[model samples]
Target: MNTDVDRVVAHLDPGPGPGMTEGAHALMREIITAEPAPAPRPARRRRPVLRLALPGVALATAAFVALSWLLPTGPGFGPGPAAALDIREENGYYVVEVKDLYAGPDRYQEQLRGVGLDVTLRLTPSTPSMVGSIFPTSPTDHRYLDEIKTIDQPGACEKMGGCPIGVKVPVGFQGPAEITLGREAAPGEEYANVTSFDALGEPMHCVAFRGRTVAEVRELLAQRGLAVHEFRDTNPYIDEEAASRTSVPDSWYVNGGYLRAPGKANLNVSEQPEESDAGGLRNCAAPQGS
Candidate 1:
């Protein structure tokens, strides 16, 4: 009997961690076959004891401890600050909400990228009624934005705070989109805000010339004797990476371009390949403290 038990014990050779080799299973089989039947003997009182395979139990406990150490903890176990914008799909369009009042435009654009749309939001001062308006064209374009016309204000939600902005973008829209919001004017001001088109006449729309570079647009405007002032590219995603105004001319940047509208010479150029996603080009006198 002792020899049979020794044979079964010899077959066991546990590997590292929880991985048991085929030899371990064979050992278990041998243990079962080598066990001797209890012989008839007088029953003797003995203290109750719990019997368990210490090696297998210890291995399982060690594996559990190792997994616990590897598991992540804390707030969702990701990187970066909490996103200030919330994006959701409603009907057929994507609804983007601004949860933070001072959230940077570039961050908003970054958050939108995950939504599969190249939409952006900028808080530009506008008339009270026209506040929270959508501008699909460059600042030079006088064509009215019809996209905002389609959106209806929704009932206030619990999450919406002071800077509640809901922008509806089409599902398949891949290009850039900008939504301009009207900023509240400071004290001693009668009205809330102003826009580029508030007082100035409708500027020339440049949808026909989308691919032209800033230098090309500048040359075109110069040929027409239109003075383009403060030419700057407007792409929220690349805004931070843009060269300094003193370092490089606006023509150097490859995205949408904006010019200070001197007098009535209407000239606005967007770098976006599509005319639908362009704006921020203009020379408007912004109200102070707005």
Candidate 2:
């Protein structure tokens, strides 16, 4: 093998010659090398207009919100202060619906003021005819409880055929006074109501009339031509459960004895014990409404 190596190397031929000649290859290289590369472009600058526009848009939105809060809205804005209880002013008085039993004296007056009046309303159990009616009895004398009087609209109201609770006062009347209304009793509850008051806001008559017995009280009221509607003997122990369900004290029924006269709220009178021999009414005062 050593003896033939030099001879084999010298006899070997190279592969086929390159397709392009040396001169042509050199010319192509010169042409490519002669051209210069273009310069890199600077990064584009962001526009200041977008930055300025954002703050202006934000300011405009804020101004619109402020105006919305500052300006008063139209009638579509929910309701007025007394709308919760459907209270509104009609004619010269405030008209209120006896929807809730516990709307107390203060609450009633407050709602009345919403319609530019200052008055208190006492609620009472009413007969069918007396419901939704307002009486203008003297603020000084309360004897009108037995009589059925209305502020000029009973006939008109009957003709209109709608039950509406109304209050009446003198022209330009501005004073603290109490009014009465009749509310029907619920299924199991006794009817409750308020007594009429004078313009001075004084209670016309004594509400709780002390009596020896319900019979005695009945006779006394009957003698005065008062119509008795319902008689209830309340047990204080039984009322504790009911008292807890309501916000105010039970004005409809007393723990002892109860009586009702037409055009009046339910009355609470004292009854003689089962074994007592006490008899007759001395200076009995009729029970009043809250």
lDDT of 2 by residue, 1-290 (tens): 01111010000001111112233223323322211111111123210110000000000122232111011111222335543234534444333443344455566555556555554555443223333333222243322221221322223322011223233343245544444443443454432321121101112223333333455444545554553443333334534223222122222322222222243322332232432223322122333431
**Across residues 139-222, which tens digit of lDDT does each residue of candidate 1 receive?**
223222345323323453211001123335566764544444433322332221211221222122222223455565556556
Q: Count the backbone clashes (under 3 Å) in each candidate.
A: 2, 19
Angstrom error at residue 159, model 2: 14
lDDT of 1 at 194: 19
Q: Highest lDDT: which candidate?
A: 1
Q: Which ten residues in a row have the lowest lDDT in candidate 1?
A: 50-59
Candidate 1 Cα deviation (angstroms), residue 254: 45
* Native-referenced Cα lDDT, model 2: 0.29
